[model samples]
Target: MSVLDFDNLTKRYGRTTALRELTLSIPEGSVYGLLGPNGSGKTTTLGLALGVLQPSGGTVRWFGAPATAATRRRVGALLETPNFYPYLSARQNLQIAADVKQTDARSLEAALETVGLAQRQREPVSGFSLGMKQRLAIGAALLGRPEVLVLDEPTNGLDPQGIADVRALVQRLAAEGRTVIMASHLLDEIEKVCTHVAVLHQGQLRSAGPVAASLATADRVVLGLAPGTAADVLRAALSSLPFVQDVRPETDGRVSCALAIGHSPASLNQALFAQGLALAHLEMRHRRLEDQFLELIKN
Candidate 1:
């Protein structure tokens, strides 16, 4: 079942349309990556999902119901840059979060420990570094023991170890059956962590589905070959085959080409063999989510 759904959502600002008829379903217990470049309305979508910003049109649902005060308790969010009272200690800041979320006040200690901030619990927020501050902000979100987590750039501005720590925590949250919605420009991270993905561009959803499913295709295949006299002969033979789009030499003595629909790897191999060239390697490269995002923005 979907934990969150946006049904024909639209948001307008004066003459600008921030979002347009956006629709998506986030499955329960999935790590969903909400991805797009800057000014692509990713942040706006997150705001609307959490009920921090009301939509001008359509509605957002949490567990098949509209976002409400009761729903807020089940959801935890880290939107934009986290802000805390500089004078307050990390422990004190989380205390405020605990008071608001109505969770156990002592859960603050558990939250601090989870984010590796146990020893710095008494340190003032102003004294914390950027990555430390980010961790503390996440600690605040985890204080409520939420069923869903909405985070924007959770690993941004962090060192390598800090990034790894945050990544591990997010993965652990999903393992514990929490639905996590993460927005980031880090495509590699999304590729690694997200089970499902939603690509947004110009405030609209370009694509939304399982990461693996979306990447599955038979559009084209790139083949690497041994550097030899058969390169031209191989190209000539494959070029005559039906559904071959284009063939070009690669920097690594390989031939890159595209295959049309109904063209199988076996057929491609057969064509190459007919020309006296043996296949060194055969790999199909599908359109990446990053490539799809760029295509949407360009259009």
Candidate 2:
């Protein structure tokens, strides 16, 4: 089931339209990534869905119903920098958050343990690293035991270790059956952790689907024939195979071609062997997510 849905959602500020007619659904139990560069309306879309900003037109729904207090209670979000009392201990800070959230203190221990801050719960926030602090912020958001979590650039300003920590934490949360919607400009991070992604550009939806399906490209298979085999023979054989596409000559005297869906390098090898050709070299070149991301936004 969809945990959230945006129907023709639009947002504007005077003459500037921050987001335009964006219709998308976030599935339950998915680690959904909102992918875009800065000012691509990623934050604006989150704001509209959270009701922090009113939509200029369209609708935001939660669990197949309009967002209300009860529905909002099911979602926890961290949209800005994590703010904490510098002198307060980690546990104390969470207590304060619990008070604000009006959630019972019974969930405090679980939140601390979930964020891996249980051991340092008594340490001052001032002494914790930026990564620890971000985890605490997420712990605070978890105070109400919300079913959905929305994080905007959860690892925006962390060290490598910090980024890894947050990424793992997000994965754990999703594993526990909570829906997570995170916005990020880092293609690698999204590609690594997100099960699904929605790419946005200039306030418009570019693409949205499961990561494998959305970013899938025909991987090119490079082939080299025996010393006695002419390149034309190889090209001719490839051309005859209807599944082979975009046959091209590599600079290193190798031929490369893409195969249709459901076709594999093994299948290609067998097909060539059936036609009295043998390969001396065979390799599959996979496409990078960065290349795909750039292609999506370049236009």
Top-lDDT structure, candidate number: 2
lDDT of 2 at 181: 98
lDDT tens readout by residue for model 2, 1-299:
99999999999999999999999999999999999999999999998888889999999999999997778778888875778999999999999988866789989999999878899999999998777888888888888888999998999667787788788988988999999999999899898999999999999999899888755553688999977667999999999999999999986578999888888999999999999998999999876777777888987
Off by over 4 Å in 1: 218-220, 224-277, 280-289
Range of the 10 consecutive residues with the lowest summed lDDT in candidate 2: 212-221
Q: What lDDT tens digits, residue by residue, belong to model 1 across residues 1-299?
A: 99999999999899998888989999999999988888778889999988788899988999999889888888888988887999999999999888889999978889999989999889899999988889888998898789999999999778999888888989999999999999987788888889998888888888888887765542457776665655666577668877777787766666777776567778889877876778887887776766765765687
Q: With candidate 2 superimposed using the best TM-score fit, by how many Å does residue 174's alpha carbon deviate from the native?
A: 1.9
Off by over 4 Å in 2: 84-93, 116-130, 227-230
Total backbone collisions for each predicted model: 0, 0
